[model samples]
Target: MADNATLKAQYLTQVEADLERNTKEKDRIATDLAALQEQLAVLEEDHALLVGVRQTLVGQAEAAAVTPAEVPVAAPAEAPVETPAEAPAAVVPRARKPRTAARKPKAAAPKKAKAAKAGVAEGGSAATAPTLVELVTAHLTGGAEPRSAAEIGTTLTQAHPDRKIQTTVVRNTLEALVAKGQALRSRQGRSVYYSAPEKVTASA
Candidate 1:
């Protein structure tokens, strides 16, 4: 009977040791679970923050497109640009042509040197002319039905010997005298003819 009691004691001791080992294992597993949960929480928080940043960047890009200056910052998701808080305002240049060089105004035309002293009137009251006019008169002498301005100018040029009388100048002068009524203008087949207006009264 003593031997049987000793054997029961031994069996009880073994059972108690097994219970302690199992308790230790359970505690270790619970500690690992707690660590894993904490790690997961930290990761989730970081993910959320990254998402907010990304959203903020996207919003800013959209705002820039609208007015190009009214940029906006959104929540997490996209990263935001690291720019200065106070951006410069936009500038617009003035619309005008820049001055480059200096320039002078043109001179006025010269007065004609040898126009008639007395402007002609209607019906030929004879008016004396300047020396060039006398030369023109002598060259066109004989009352021989006035000559062309070109012919008159050529004849005067020959008599003057050293003057440059352009045909255009002569034509202009002859037309001026004709307008003054000192000479008559005659057009025969494109050739212009001029003569001293007859010096006489209209009714005699």
Candidate 2:
């Protein structure tokens, strides 16, 4: 009977110890599970935030694609309208009927004054100015001997300082007079000399 009691006490003590160890292990696993759950909640919050940002960016891009940019359209150019050829005659008679007869005498007065001024100016200049051809002929006639083109040109240029007489023009006029038989041209060697027809006859 005493051996049976001792064995029963030993088994009861061992069962209590095992029960305490199982309770401590259960508490430790609960703490570990709580930490893991907290970490998972943080990850889920970060995922939700990233997904919201992505959706907002995608929405903006879709909106931009749907809406087009505005462009200004140009106005069309208008073509010019042409009047008929007979339209001027119809318009002129209506516009100028009252003023036509009244304005004619007034317009004619200024035209007559202009014509008088022009006539006086022309007549005065014509009476005073001797022609270049007449001057050249008179110079050749007055000269005693046959003159070279250069000598005649120099004398005429000196006598009339106001005149712009070129030697080439003088030579051309002498040739024309020679052709018309009004002046005589003689050549001594390569030098050409000119005189009036009467002078040439006297010299001969």
Candidate 3:
């Protein structure tokens, strides 16, 4: 009877140890399953993101294929019309209307008087003003010594302050006079001088 009890006690202790081991194994297995489930969830999210990107790209490509290409059409050219030539028509003279007797001659007379006064003023100024060529010629003749274009321009500007005389214009006029044999052009060193032919002959 004591042997039976000892054996039974040994069996019971072994069963308790086995039950504790089984419980620990079950807990370890549950932890591994939870980690595996989390990995699966991450993989599923990545797969959805990739699928969405691919679908967006495919939709853009489909939209591009559905859109029509724009092409410019040129307008047609117009045809010119030819017309037949006709003979010239005769011109008829219109009848003249007589002037009214009640028309004021005094109003017309004042306008004609103003026009005449303006004409006289313009003619008097035009007659009194000497030409540029005439002035240049008179200056050259009046000067005794041969003068450079600069000296001539200065003298003319001082004498005729109203006239806008340029040195280039004076030089051009001197060159023209030289071409026409009306004036003599002499060069001393690098400076050029001009004088009337009469003055040159008198100085000579």
Best by TM-score: 2
Check candidate 2 and list the clashing pairs: none
lDDT per residue for candidate 1 within 45-151, as digits (tens), equals: 54553464455456556867776443333323123221211121112243322111111111111111122223334213544334554555555444566577788
156-185 in candidate 3: lDDT tens per residue?
899999999988667766666675688887
Better of 1 and 2 by TM-score: 2
Off by over 4 Å in 3: 1-117, 201-204
Give me the runs in candidate 2 sitting further than 4 Å from their true place.
1-103, 201-204
| Better by lDDT, candidate 2 or 1 | 2
Q: What is the TM-score (0 to 1) of candidate 2?
A: 0.46
Candidate number with greatest lDDT: 2
User: Between prediction 2 and prediction 3, which has the larger TM-score?
Assistant: 2
Better of 1 and 3 by TM-score: 3
Each model's C-alpha lDDT?
0.55, 0.73, 0.70
Error of 3 at 115 (Å): 1.6
